[model samples]
Target: MSTSDMQDANLQEALVTYEKLQDIEDDMDEVEVEILRQQDKLCKDIYAKRAEVITKIPQFWPLVIEQAPPDVDEYIQPSDSALLLNSLVNLTVERFELPQGDPRSVSIKWEFKENEYFENKVLEKKFWWRRARDGWAGLVSEPVDIKWKEGKDLTGGMLGLVQKVWEEEKAGKEGETEAAKKLKQLMEDTGLGGVSFFAWFGFRGRKISAEEDKEAFQKEQEHRQARKAGKETEEDAMDEDDDDSDDDEYEMEIFPTADDLAVCISEDLWPGAIKYFTNAQEQDDMSDIDFESDDEMDEDEPEGDAPANKKRKA
Candidate 1:
């Protein structure tokens, strides 16, 4: 081969290798970006899970501990403790306890047999607690072997279970405290145990009675009716007063005879009465009192104008 051809071949090979390297670098950059995004998403999910578990642990622990069977009959004498302890031991297997430092880190295992349907189940829950400053914390947990049986009266069934646990704990077989026994008994006796644990823990609000709503509605209606009746009575009284005034006006009379209707020749009312009488007589064609004629232009037309006097031949 010629020297120039060999040189050209080497340059071409170098250019192709450089382009391949750039492509590989771009691919690596994309992969790294995607990996970072995935990591961020995973961390967020973990934090969320932890937060939920932490929030639930404190609330769940108290109820579970409270409802557990009692270990000793602290109320009864020392001799009776053995009897109660024996009864508890015969029915239940193990006792669950809240961890000392962080509640979220607690683990619980409960094993029980369902004699009604002849089934055995073991429930286990694992938790992890992450602490923060100012007493804040997060938790992550998983539950295993929790079952949803068919045809179960959910409320009644759960209450029954808690009641049974309470009984066992009361006998001291389930390793529950004396306080727990008391709480369990109280809840069961008050019919609160039949409620879902979440509801009992204040997750839900209590319902109001229909009677209360009806009573409130009736009160509002009565108030409205009373106001309406008062308005109607006021209107009726006003109408009655108006009718009385009309009757008084109808009974009043105005009578003016010709003598009483005579016009006095006083300056104050003379002009008005003269103008009125003149207009009236003119309109009625009564020209006997011919004040317009010079013959009747006397200084006084008597006190009031009357019928013309008849004069005999002079």
Candidate 2:
């Protein structure tokens, strides 16, 4: 064969190998789903017990939120933290649809005591791990409504702006409409990327109906099966590009980063809440010790020499 013929053969060989690898990865993902289901079953009672104990501790959930990982803490501004510390009483994450619909679906319930922040006693955000169009599947959630008291809104009007954009989209406006531009401008003006972490409750990432998602998901599965069996039709080959192109459209979402934020909550914030609280305690203790040591050193040294020391440090 000529050199060109050999290159063509190599390209074809590479494509076949890539399809085989994708098939294996898809199978691994299925196993992962089962593992998640089993993990929930194993941890249900443990989480329930912990929930009972932690709720008794004053500000347990509040401190957990206050000392959350950077990815989460960045959302909890001082104002938002104040509301949470004052009102947030208990938080629980559960597979609300486990063994019924999707095991991966979680309801993160935030129980609030009576406070000036809002009227609702409990705020729950459910993240449904449903399949969407174009073989894409991840956590998608609807925004929860947080009824704030007059002049107590922490999200800086972001939730309302997002709702306006959604309303416009529902009313037939699409693709970076005027409302979306305003939403984007509000995010920039807030300088927090997402206004407040509390605004996360109002994030709506995907816009497809359940019926459409289900139909597309079925077609995606069929396409995957065809690829795995090396029975992909010419039509399937053409549709492959179209499927990938839809993914880029998600970036235009009003809350494009919300999906990543969701992962941080489910994986790091909820799963490791106790650990974060413990870490906060440890850091506080260390800070106290350091402060004491600094005081002792200050006393041992002359106060008049502080300026000299500062000059030397500079």
Candidate 3:
């Protein structure tokens, strides 16, 4: 055969190979669904066993949060730390949509004792795995209201104020108001409006029309398969610069870092609590060390306690 004939043959072979790869990817996605289902069942049983153990341990959740990596620790303001230490008793994360809905979704519940900070006995935040209009998918959640006591708001009222502004803007149909702008300024201010980690409960991410989002997702997937099969079409030629992944306009405001914080809690701190707790204890042990020999490491160590001077942040 001529050189041109060989080139055409090779191109056809490549297209066939690409089509095979797309089929394998689609099969993998199906397998992932079953894997998530199994994981959901396993986690439910594990969480039940953990619930009994964690409640007996004093300050278990707080210690885990305290020892979180610096990225997460930065969100825990001093007041937030104190509130968790005093009031937070039990924290649990579960695939709440079991038996029917998507198991990828999770609910994080915080069981708190009666405290001056908030009135509620329980605060739970549910995050759903949702796709936006542009087909990008992640965790999207509704805002959770935190009923603050008269003078004990850990968010410095920023979250509450943001919520109020969001409602007002939504009702008025006004584009953006002076109050929203001022609130943004206050949030930036150093003293008056420091946001707390607990404000993460009030996070509201993208949730436009569900049908449109799903349609876009389906369209994107079809286009992806076409591209993999070496087919060029209008969808492939569509403007790459077009972006629709921003949080829906219905959300007047957002906790900018909420997604990162949410993942940290659900994925890292919740799942790896035992590791974080052990690390916290090891940290406490290191502070009291007087290592005379290598064998001293395994010997009965002193009872590690929280720092005596760890006073409430005023």
Best by TM-score: 2
| Candidate with more favorable, higher TM-score: 2 or 3 | 2
User: How large an RMSD does model 1 have?
Assistant: 48.9
Rate residue 279 of model 2 by lDDT: 80
The backbone clash count of each candidate, in order, is 6, 0, 0
**Error of model 3, residue 148, in angstroms:** 1.5
Candidate 2 lDDT over residue span 1-314, tens digit each: 99999999999899888888888898998898788788888888888888888867887887788788888777666777888888788877787777756677777878888988788999888887766554557777776777878987777777766667667767887577776777678766666564666777776656556786679768877878788678853332346665565564453344567767777877788879899889878877877777677666777887676522321110
The total number of steric clashes, by the backbone 3 Å criterion, in model 2 comes to 0
List CA RMSD, all candidates.
Answer: 48.9, 4.3, 7.2
TM-score of structure candidate 3:
0.72
Query: Which residue pairs come into collision in candidate 3?
Result: none
lDDT of 3 by residue, 215-274 (tens): 876786787767666676443343344343252332344366677777777767887889
Candidate 1: stretches off by over 4 Å:
1-104, 117-120, 132-135, 143-145, 153-194, 197-314
Worst 10 residues of 1 by lDDT: 252-261
TM-score of 1: 0.19
Alpha-carbon lDDT of model 2: 0.74
lDDT of each: 0.34, 0.74, 0.72
